[model samples]
Target: MMRHLRSIMRITWVDKVPSKEVLERTGLPSMEDLLTRKNLRWTGHLMRMSPNRLPNKSIYSQMPSVHRKRGRPRLRFKDTIKRNQKLRDIKTHSLASLSQQRDKWREIVK
Candidate 1:
């Protein structure tokens, strides 16, 4: 008599998913078809390059001075005083009276 055997395989992250262009170049069927095939296998994760870390001393040394300008300076208007004076000279009126007159004219037209 004989007995059946089973085996397991480990996949690494370097094996990436196939792109559409690669599938087209290889003359393979749709991705769905490839995934459904009995022999098709894939690794679940992707590999990425490690990020570069700066030294603590360098990061602290590059701190901006508290007194120095951090960004673009604001625009200063020389005629601000004159502009405010002109604004103050303009007559103030109630907006409610203007709306009432407009409604009266519309009612007369209709």
Candidate 2:
């Protein structure tokens, strides 16, 4: 992504332009930040859904007790959301309440 940005700006590595300067010059955010914001926004949407809805249930549902042979458990969507929330310094306990307010949630996610 940085490569594409640099190309668009007609910059080369030889110019020694830092990625941060490129992003600032283009008035854009980093790819990771964009993804994190999108995920958190979607999570807020899910939080506003009815509890019985499939998407909402899937996120808050309890998993059955079953042992796995895995050395590391696969990351789930919920885990990803939690990580994103932490990155943004959002409190987990307030997620549901905050998300219920669409305008507020949008501001917080940004």
- Per-prediction tally of clashes: 0, 0
Give me candidate 1's TM-score against the actual structure. Answer: 0.15
Task: Write the residue-wise lDDT of candidate 1 on 3-109 in tens digits.
Answer: 11111112223544335534454555654443322111110000011223333233224436457577865432213322322433311243223224545423322
- Per-candidate Cα lDDT values, in order, are 0.30, 0.90
Clash pairs (backbone) in predicted model 1 = none
Over 4 Å off in model 2, which ranges?
none
lDDT of 2 by residue, 38-104 (tens): 9988998898899899998888888898988868998999899989989988898998899999999
Write down the RMSD of all candidates, one decimal each. 29.1, 1.6
Instruction: Evaluate residue 16 in candidate 1 and report its C-alpha lDDT on the 0 to 100 scale.
Output: 44
How well does each candidate superpose onto the true structure, as a TM-score?
Answer: 0.15, 0.87
Colliding pairs, model 2? none
**Candidate 1 wrongly placed segments (more than 4 Å):** 1-18, 34-110
